[model samples]
Target: MRVQFSIALAHLLRRRRSTLVSLLGISLGVAFFLAVSALMRGSERDFLKRLVDNSPHITVLDQYRSARVQPAELRWPDAAVAISNVKPPVETRGIRSHRSKLESIEGWPGLRVAPVLRGSAVLTFAGQQQGVSLSGIVPARMKDVSTIDEQMVAGTLDDLAAAPNGLVIGQGLAEKFQLGLDSTVSMVTASGGARVMKVVGIFRTGNAAYDEGETFTLLKRAQVILARPNRVNRFIIQLADPQQARTVAAGIEQAIGYKSVSWIEASEDLLSLLLVRNIIMYSVVTAILVVAAFGIYNTISTIVVDKRRDIAILKAMGFSATDIRHIFLYQGAVIGLLGSCAGLMLGYGMMHVLASVELKPPGVSDVVHLPVWWGAEQYLLAIAFAMAACLCAAYLPANKAGKLQPVDTLRGAI
Candidate 1:
């Protein structure tokens, strides 16, 4: 094996140009694979972070996911009685007995819950009217679960608690209505009730739709203006570890009989899209390494054709077929090992360069740098795949070399 490896090294060194070209190809492939994977995976993580930070981990709505089964259906076991057009009774459109339900939820450890009465209302300022989503929140509880506190540009959520008639609005809405803190605005609800409220706080979330269409006030005030006293339609919850939201939401839904939605469930489509994107990315990048492998194949195949006499001579001199094959396979392994090392260093440099780039996109207030993920698994994966490709490429040539006949080679040379 040592003799075979020495011969393999000598062959590669003799065909220096071809070997270097193959090595360069493999290195470039691995480098690009790492750099691109870092960017894509990093962007995914950044997007998810923003989503998790901005919204509740779990939202408990004032509705049931499925219709209630009638008592007749429960009593009969596989009875073929069919009921048609069974219209359910009209009831109040809010979470029933919310206080007791909220208390039950509060008993759970590592959860922060804030009750919200979300509704729609028209805002009138200086004869300009705009419809916006009105959310009634307990300021103190809301601060614990939401990023609104951090996003506040002018005032704090505590302002809502201090002033019962205080309103917290987004920067987009304030700009549209030409209003500021301490400004008065009339808000009219669909229930034919109107109230003049004072602007106490302003927030900017950088999302145009949300910034322009959302406002918040005290829970009690929202209940009064929306004509639903002592009622809350939603419970916004944040968990100690957001990843456990799915399990926690299921438990809450079963216990309270309300519709509970986790962020993971709500973003299922986006998550699926990201997964598909990663698959496509990996396939395309892996193809680059595969193409580089073809270079290795061509180089080894050429060597086998040129050195048939040498292979036959070795076989005649008692070199086993397996030993001859190892000589060629060793060449591929060496190339793969060296190329992968060089590629990893090059890829890290590329990622560093990318991370330094800064740009200010449209509508954004500050410059943003590219996101780059540095995970050890990505490096290991690139090296492993490149080596596998190199080995597979060398196999055919190695086998051909091992099968050379001394008599046939001598006759052909003559």
Candidate 2:
């Protein structure tokens, strides 16, 4: 085995140019794979972080997911008769008896729940009017469940509590209205009820739509403006472990009989899209390594052809066909091992360089660096994939060399 390995090493060193080319190909492929994977996975994680941070882990809405069964349908069991155009009974749009429902979920461990009343209102200022989403919240509870406190650029949620008529608006809205702190904005609800609220806070969330169209006020204030006093339509929930949101949301829905949606459920489509994106990205990057394998195959194949007489002489001197096969396989393994190591180093350097690069995105106030995830698993994956490709590439030539008859090869050489 040692003699076989030594011969393989000598052969590779003899064809240094071809060997170097193959090594370079494999190394470059592995390097690019690592760099791309780190960046992509890092970006994915960063995006999810922002998404989870900005939105509720779970939201309990005032509506039911399914329509209520009619008394007629309930009374007549197994009736095939179809009920058509059954208008559900008219009731108030907001959640009924929300206080009791909120009380029922109180004291649940690792949960922060805040009641909110969301409605659309038109903000009129300086003769300019824009429609905006208004959310009514308890400043104290909201601070526990929301990232708005961290995202606040000026003033605070507590300020809304201090002043009943205070409003929190996003920077985009503030800029659009050309208003600042203490600026008064006229808000008219869907019912034509109007209220004058002073802007006490401005927040920037880096999302244009939210920044431009979302506003917040005290829960009581929102009820008065929307003309549904003492009613709350939504409960925003944050969990200590966001991954447990689905289970908690289901439990909450069962407990309170309202529609509870987890962030995972709400963003299912986006998650699926990301999964598909990752699959495509890995497939494309893996193809580079697969292509690089061809270089190894060609180099090994050429060596096998060029070293036929040497192989024949070795076999004539009592070397087995298995020994010849091992020689070629060893060459492939060496190339794989060395190339993977060099590639990893290069990839790490690339990741650092990428992490250092900063770009100012449009409409963003601060420069952001590239996200690079440094997971050991990705390194293992790259090496495993590259080595597999190398081994597979080596197999064909090894098998062919192993099949060579010493007598036939010597006759050809002579």
Against the true structure, what is each candidate's TM-score? 0.93, 0.93
Per-residue lDDT over 1-414 for candidate 2, one digit per residue giving the tens place of the 0 to 100 score: 888889889989999999999999989999999999999999999999999999999999999989888888889967889787898777657878888888887767889889999999999999999999999999999999999999999999999988889999999999999989999989998887799999999999989899999999999999888888889999999999999999999999998899999999999999999999999989998999999999999999999888888888888998888888999999999999999999999999999999999999787779999999998999999999999999999999999998888898888843
Segments of candidate 2 deviating more than 4 angstroms: 103-109, 313-321, 362-365
Most TM-score-accurate candidate:
1
Give per-candidate clash totals: 0, 0
Model 1 agreement with the true structure over 305-412: per-residue lDDT tens digits: 888888888988999999999999999999999999999999999999999999999878889999999989899999999999999999999998888878889789
